[model samples]
Target: MARSLLPAPDARGPFSPGFWRSPLRGTWFTSVLGVVLLAGVTVLFVTGLLSYAAYNPDLSPVNDKTPDKGILGFYLFSWPTDPPWLYRLTQGVHVTLGLALVPVLLAKLWSVVPRLFTLPPARSLTHALERISLLLLVGGALFEFVTGILNVQLDYVFPGSFYPLHFYGAWVFFGAFLAHAVLKAPVAFRNLRRMREGGEERADGQADELAAPRPDPPTVSRRGALGLVGGGSLLLLATSAGRSFDGPLRQTAVLTPHGGPEPGGGPNGFQINKTAAYAGIRADETGEEAWRLAVTGRSGTVRLSRADLLGLPLHSAALPIACVEGWSTSDQWWRGVRLRDLAALVGHDGPVDVFVESLQRRGAFRHAALRANQVGDPRSLLALSVNGEELTPDHGHPARIIVPAAPGVLNTKWVARLTFGAL
Candidate 1:
């Protein structure tokens, strides 16, 4: 047999080919995991982009989180308001699938870790480039996954804002991910085909750098290893996917922060991301005698009290509140005045962008801007009540904004003003 260029087994540490003792450490195993991630991460990237666009990031200085997105924003479009549950489904899949893929990602990394300690690091220019790409692929994956999990849990301990950090990190990570996938896809497919044709031993025989010179005795078959990874993924999915739903299934979402019985109870009880007190809502301000809504447009500013808003034509819609954090509420009976009606009162007779302001004293998204499509949706409302009861102080007592297919934060609790026109 031709002598391998890699260091002999007598060498110490990971630089020795014999140091990697797992019989499972071979090209076929790594290739299989790579193929699965190639398809999964692609879907994850696309849905993540869709989630960003749903925020109307084009509304600069208002709803835009990554203000300097530049060319990255090229694919952004006015997110549709139809289907009503569009954002809910996309974001739900994005978060849930992301968590479920953790085991596969970790296993893929383990299968290829020996490469990181290769002696001499690079044998040629092509080899050097491949090593560099691999480094970026691994580092970027870790950063994106860690930061994303923390964000979903509402942990902001990391440096920089979550929006911009995650946005830019995704672009860099996916760029390297695509490059690596393109370079290795042909070999991976070949390995998969060899295994499928009962040529598994032949495929293992042709193992490249991933094969250990002196592997340990096999404790489990390759198929068994894959089964273990898949089982772990399914376990995570069962515990995390329920946060996006309602009823008993929600209890299964023990992995999520908002999972378990609904917070509090009764008609007014559902889920409140931030309470009125937490938002600095004073008792005197939200009271019917004190609260007033300011509507502005071509007709100029017109202030209306809560009673006056009630006197206007009332409408109702069953809408859900879906947050970027991945937790969502079931459809609740919401009663209030239509956003279009409010726009008309301010002289905007047709679909036009609207800027919404809230009385929130702390935190991000105290105000938000909605696109014309969102404003045109007749289901959008300045909700004054839910489940047929008056709004609780925590639920935006006087009124709140509820736009179909919009993010939960953009719903703008404790709404104080509505400006109908180009945002």
Candidate 2:
């Protein structure tokens, strides 16, 4: 009986309930969430780059004041559109994802608070540098999140232009992210390997060992406070996201006629006159015979002389020209005819793509091709006049292809020739 004594079973790893109670668990969760949050920021950054490349007025000085249209523009402004249900739903997801990050960031900060007491793993000159790097990263991340949220509210905190802050801050953030990654790479890799080899139990034990020792009486108070703060922040963010989903406030601008002497009627009412420019050509005066449109590519080569096009049925309509830069203007317009109709005149079959060339050929000549379905869209017009008057030279006078709801670049002003090809 005296020799029957035995030892008790071994205790569970550091990641057990006992271990998670320590401050280390909070730091771990925060670190993981930080990575996830950075991923979201990356997505927003890439989208901004694409928008800039697309000559988004919001980021461009040339047409920054112009009105914007198209799907990408709408997404940038977070505006509701014709597809009400679909728009709101997608926008809600975007806003919610953005806003949800706020609490996650806060929780991460809270978790990292206890790390101040503990010594960093590195003690060399390199380690000292790494510590400084981490501090800078934390500060930059905080600034990015704060400014980003303010941007969502349309509150421009920095003076001068929003572009400088948005664009320059991006590079700084990227540098910090890279530094953080380099510093944490080895530890992260080690932890991953240990987890993979030891399974859940070993991982849990490791977490427990890393956590701070709990004071007697089970110090659960901090956890409760964190839960409350995180919940409240999330709720606030969700409420804001809900409101944005309701749709943007509409503010209509008064219409003004900018051509020569205004027509007999006032701005409120207008009409389209076909005698004006169409396809950058007037009916009576024949331009250089050399000014023929050469259609090439998928439909084979077909040249349509100005006379040949004029013989086709001429149609005109007044439609709104909305630019992606947030400017909108309506024109009681005379256009050559429907683009789809013109395509038919040249025997344009299903597979043809369209590109319009301008006489000036200044700057970058805009080019776009429409899918078979997009060609027949009611809003597509080759405009000739605005408000019963000829278009001003600056406004793509003579003739411009106006695709309503498309970006201004795709509108193709001062069109002199047309070409068809595969997209």
Candidate 3:
């Protein structure tokens, strides 16, 4: 049997490997994993923005009434107004994605660490920037992931507002990532071009000398590896799926028998009434002819009458209405027709944006416009009832918009009219 010889460390740096060392398989694995994890982060960030845009404040009364309870309730504390199913679903996705990122990031760090000691050529300012950007990228990513996980686990126990940190940190993450990509663009392009031309540039020159060219190592058989990855992703998806189904998950934090007397009827009890309100709107004492839902902007001039709306097919959903505020309530049955169906009645073939106007006309209340996608999303609806009862005057008596999985602000209340036009 032949004995294997281990390479000695460099004289200059005790830990440094020879100049022409070979890149390890772990490096390739980490690189691929890092790219995938980065893509996941981008998706999560964009989706979060979309959810924010779709938020409907009208749907969140608790937040409006008790700002502190509302603020702390949804994200951290449990409140009477929190939407049971929706909150859990969003939280699950937020936390699970956060946790999944840990190992991937760790592997990436481990892969690139060896390069730090080698001190590769930094031929220009751009090269130096690229190196620095890589470090920042790693640091920012680690910071975001670690803080995010801790925030979720600790339920955001920081002294100040975690929102400021999370929100501002996102910009930093975005900037660092953008800088890193820009810095690496030229080299990446060149590397791609080289590969296309059958020219290889090994990270370590010794790859050619020490290791004979062999068929690429099967990182698990393709099908088997894909199965494993798919299985893991599916498991995550499954964990969140329960929230969408009608079960205990569908319940909200609001106490049952809403109108029933409580220890304190003021803030602790269910303050919003559901049925009487919807009935009043249907009666239209304000005059049915006067009621108009105006469509403005790109879709051209169009108006919907009361009859036109009622004529459309009605669909009811017991979906939870989660606010960014901490409190949650569940099983507040929503009875309404889908917004998409209503839009279609107006002959909307594609996307349409519209602003919602309320009758109240005071306080934090304000009009908001919905982009085409938000208005068209299947989960968006014009609610007529709450918990199988008609809406109460205090809770958008006439009509309200309910956007599942969105924050409270986006859900417009007392939807007197919808003006479709530029804001």
- Report lDDT (CA) for all predictions: 0.86, 0.49, 0.51
The residue-by-residue lDDT of candidate 3 on 226-345, one tens digit each, is 345556655644443333223344232122222123222222123332233432344453346666656444446566665666666767765554433322344456777677666665
Candidate 3 vs. true structure, TM-score: 0.46
lDDT of 2 at 126: 78
lDDT of 1 by residue, 52-130 (tens): 9999888748788888889999999998887788888888888888888999999999998887777665678888787
lDDT of 2 by residue, 138-198 (tens): 6766766666556544566755455445545655666777877666655555564665587
- RMSD to the true structure for each prediction, in A, is 3.2, 14.9, 13.7
Winning model by lDDT = 1
Residue 293 displacement (Å), model 2 = 26
Model 2 vs. true fold: TM: 0.44
Best by TM-score: 1
**Error of model 3, residue 248, in angstroms:** 9.1
- TM-scores, in order shown? 0.95, 0.44, 0.46
Off by over 4 Å in 3: 1-15, 18-27, 55-99, 118-128, 183-241, 244-332, 335-405, 408-423
C-alpha lDDT (0 to 100) for residue 44 of candidate 2 = 52
Candidate that beats the other on lDDT, 1 or 2, i.e. the better one: 1
